[model samples]
Target: MTSRFMLIFAAISGFIFVALGAFGAHVLSKTMGAVEMGWIQTGLEYQAFHTLAILGLAVAMQRRISIWFY
Candidate 1:
């Protein structure tokens, strides 16, 4: 994907990551057990990692410094 698209995707993903994290902590926490909560946490962590990776890729692409790597 292009750098612009990657940046937009990363922004959206980051937004979802934060939203889901808050939802899990404030809303789901009341109903879910520790194990379920842990699962949510794990998923959010992965989402966060990927979001950052996408952001990095977008920056690299924009700078034209890591095109070959991508």
Candidate 2:
């Protein structure tokens, strides 16, 4: 994908990351056990990191790193 599209995807993913995090912390915490909550938290962290990686890739694409990135 192009850098612009990658950025848009990253924005969407970031929004999802935040939304799911809030849902897990506020809503799931009450019902889910500590272990389950921990797992969810770990998954969210990974999502957040991956979202950042997407942003980085977008920047790289914008810089014209390679034709293969297009």
- Among these predicted structures, which one has the highest TM-score? 1
Task: Let me know the TM-score candidate 1 reaches against the reference structure.
Answer: 0.94
Across 1-70, the per-residue lDDT of candidate 2 in tens digits comes to: 6899999999999999999999998999999999999999999999999999999899888997765654
Clash totals in order: 0, 0
The segments of candidate 1 whose C-alpha lies over 4 angstroms from its true place after superposition are none
lDDT of 1 by residue, 5-39 (tens): 99999999999999999999999999999999999
Question: Against the true structure, candidate 1 has what lDDT?
Answer: 0.95
Candidate 2 has its poorest 10 consecutive residues by lDDT at 61-70
Over 4 Å off in model 2, which ranges? 66-70
Cα RMSD to native, each candidate?
Answer: 1.0, 2.2
Q: In model 1, what are the clashing residue pairs, if there are any? A: none
* 57 Cα displacement, candidate 1 (Å): 0.3
